[model samples]
Target chain A: MILAPQALLSAQQQIQRDLHSCLDYFDLPHPLKDAVHHAVMLGGKRVRPALVYASAQLDGDVMSAAARRAAVAVELIHCYSLTHDDLPCMDNDELRRGQPTCHVAYGEATALLAGDILQSMAFEVLGSRMFDTADLPNPAIALRQMQLLATASSKMVCGQVLDLQAEGQSIDQSHLENIHRNKTGALIQAAIMLGATTVLPVAHPSFTHLRIFGQSLGLAFQVQDDILDITADTEVLGKTAGKDIQVQKSTYPALLGLDAAQVYAQQLHDQALEALQQVTGNTQPLQDVTQFLLHRQS
Target chain B: MILAPQALLSAQQQIQRDLHSCLDYFDLPHPLKDAVHHAVMLGGKRVRPALVYASAQLDGDVMSAAARRAAVAVELIHCYSLTHDDLPCMDNDELRRGQPTCHVAYGEATALLAGDILQSMAFEVLGSRMFDTADLPNPAIALRQMQLLATASSKMVCGQVLDLQAEGQSIDQSHLENIHRNKTGALIQAAIMLGATTVLPVAHPSFTHLRIFGQSLGLAFQVQDDILDITADTEVLGKTAGKDIQVQKSTYPALLGLDAAQVYAQQLHDQALEALQQVTGNTQPLQDVTQFLLHRQS
Candidate 1:
């Protein structure tokens, strides 16, 4: 389940470079451009981008420009969601990745606009000629990718709305699952689906399998995140640890016991890996990603 | 230049029906769904949708599903922007289209989510099967339309950022143009371009002419808006009046005297009409729309 450390590092670097290049494409003004860069280039796991790369690797070793664009697009969305989620109206977290959140560094209004522009740019990258290669850009694939990203993004926003509404309320397990499923799982699933669409036909069996795997992995990632929020410190988490508790937000650990949450996360991780059995091609990267998510400290 | 009153009314009704049907496609819960419907359906002229239908009529009389979807998509983005702009963090407007704003009806969080989801839905409609007609759905066309919308939307957001930054500051004429170009002009241009793409090739001479026409019309539209903000009352405007001066946001009337601003608007209006000479279509709708924007009170 473990990835080769050097290979993973190189993939991560490629994603980082591609993402920075994507940002360079925009003709934005000063503080706004800087704010976008800070939100995107700052330290983080780049898990969504990595997922895009890994899933595309399932189809071939040599990644296409479309795959790279898909990777960057998903990451941009992830970055935008984080920026907005940390806004004063939302999570209101002062720190993220051990640094000042977007709103703190660039004023609240700038941060809001930055997040918005990033979302627009993500779709722009997906649909633009910039992503076309020797094979010529497949408009159908691009359209599908745009659709997937938009659906996931809308679902993610819906999750945020639900999460905000659920604050200070005693929600049940199913309600909690619904929130995380839309909030975190939707985008994660989209990242995997987007990668697969780049290389596979829409009707391919692998598409369904990858979606299932992504769903399980997405939920597992959220469960582990909740666990880490309770177990890890501020320095280790690189965010405001115990902030969830401070805000009295619902969490897997809060509903299920800490031990049960851990067990559920493991169960979901196994479910994700099991779904991969139905998928073809090199699934090792997918397995490694799932394992990484399961063991991640932050 | 006036459109047949019945024809325009029917086009407006069609756009309204399509928009409602598009919203019905989502499986969102109670208040969230209700909030989105309220933001979209409650009020406002369907000017953008009319432009789409009008532009499409140039190619043929029978409007395709793609054209209809494009029409709804532009309106969705417009609705989303207005909702977000009216947020507490932004303009904090209490009314829109003679009705209470989205945030005033729903809470701020719901309003924010409503705006975010509406944006996502706009892209979703463009890329959805709903847009696919007998032509097998040109993915290239869909992708191009998406790129056009995304680019315009991002520019609009950047304009908002610039406008916010310019508030309370002494900005020059070029600066004011930059702000309006991004904020209002971009989407208006996008609405025109999107409609043209549905019927014309990317490299077509008409496309260029339509773009030029859209640009001049967009600027003229904003200039007229600024004029109306000063001259019209709240009820007549369907929103707060003289609020621009209250916010100290620079306007055409502020920079130039009222007479001069009116003259400038007329010049731009003429410029818009001039650009249409290079285009070939049933351009009566475009001409009528320009006239409506120039004379609109609300």
Candidate 2:
């Protein structure tokens, strides 16, 4: 059963609310806090956290506080990465999520600190009692989940470093895949796993299915993002279009052409849906999420 | 009882070995792996990790694996921060711990990635089985400990930001103190707390005492470092002396005068020893660590 459009939008809104509240707790110095607060306020799809909430729900822990906190954790990490990635030292874009990039609104140093604070705060929020009541196994399970998030964040950073290294290089598809897999795929997969892991103690057997769903969804999300980089309007995307070309970044569209990229995204989306089969819950939201990831306009 | 000199040296050497072995499992990029190997070879007193080992031993979790891994985690975080602290975007120091700093030896990009890898590896080491063997609470406790480390690391980054911001400014004592506390003191305190937190459960009563000890030790270390900036010879310190003055960044020595700075360090050292009073067990190593933090020649 596919989730109704209204229902999916509502879920996305709820995740965004929680994400906004969680980000509000961070207090950095001066205009940097304002810059970060504004950056988050501009708001992306909240897709990563939504997937977390959606997948955890499928595993029987749907909308639990633990799931929400983990969702928020993954999203904060993602936002932090975006802020840093857009800095002059890296991709150097002046806009993001449809607003001035962090460094453009704030100085480079403050922007750097803001991202660092958000990254650390994400772990703090997840480890706190906000989700402590989520019927998850003792603190150990929560700790393991947080550890996984950190691993994902680290991989993302490594990917950023590699991406920075790859600029202007005539890289092949494999290298490009490695970069995105580490950069985007790691966090996306972590977001899904973070949601699913909350149901682990009670639904231990379903992890493999959730992992498959997460892995496929993560790759599909990246492919769509690559497509957006080439196809979306700057006003609609809220960031500079043709950034892939400007930075000379190798993307699926760049390597495989836009049409082939679409086919690849569809295949990954189908794999994501097939992975949802092992679970016996309402798979509607999961279906919608897969479709939204692959087919969304911006 | 004060630990015999040989005993302290032996413990430090052992920690170096364990930390080296921890990195052995990671198949990192060449320059990164090579830079870290070079960093570990820098024969600075492993003061922070020693404090960890000493405090855990003082807390009577003697023969505990938690003590050792916690030691490794703290030191790795220390090394990671140092590697980045020396980056051109930050301190831009060309030398550290006697040899060329990470950025100087391996281009700035690799140095940054190396710092990142080391940071991730610190959490990984903490979450590994070696730290879990002593019936440590749950992954929650370990995760919380890691979170605490992250918080400190973030604070250190903030401090670095503050220090960088203060460059060329007419900073007073309070501002200097804030900079040192955030940049240097936070991690020092973390070293002590990481050691204690590992042995006791997350909610243990002793954490506060260990925190005080860490705070005092951290301040003492920073003041002593400031004192060294003026008093220690370049050859002895293995870095340029009076670089702080050269940069015009305010420091304890700059604010308090040389004699006053020495007195301030003594006060902090005593406070650290006093803070250790709440813990039961052998007190010698902890005392030595405090002394080492304050009065080490190099």
DockQ scores for all the models shown? 0.76, 0.45
Q: Which clashing pairs does model 2 show?
A: A57-A62, A98-A238, A140-B139
Q: What are the chain B TM-scores of all models?
A: 0.95, 0.91
The sequence of per-residue lDDT tens digits that candidate 1 reaches over residues B1-298 is: 3344555677889998998889888888667988999999985778888878878777777888878888999999999999989988889999998899998999787887788888889998898867454554568878888988999989999899889889999988889998998899999988888888878877888988888888888888899899999999998788999999999999999999899999999999999899987899778777877777787766
For B207-261, candidate 2 gives per-residue lDDT tens digits of 7877887788888888888888888888888887889899897888777888998
Candidate 2: list runs displaced more than 4 Å: A1-4, A59-62, A131-137, A164-172, B1-4, B30-32, B35-43, B59-63, B130-137, B168-175, B201-205
Docking class of 1: medium
lDDT of 1: 0.87
Q: For model 1, how does the per-residue alpha-carbon lDDT over A123-181 read when each residue is reduced to its tens digit?
A: 99887766454554688889889989999999998898888879899999999999999
User: Interface Cα RMSD for candidate 2?
Assistant: 2.6
For every model shown, the clashing-pair count is 0, 3
Docking quality of model 2: it rates as acceptable
Q: How much is B78 displaced in model 1, in angstroms?
A: 1.0
Among the numbered candidates, top TM-score falls to 1
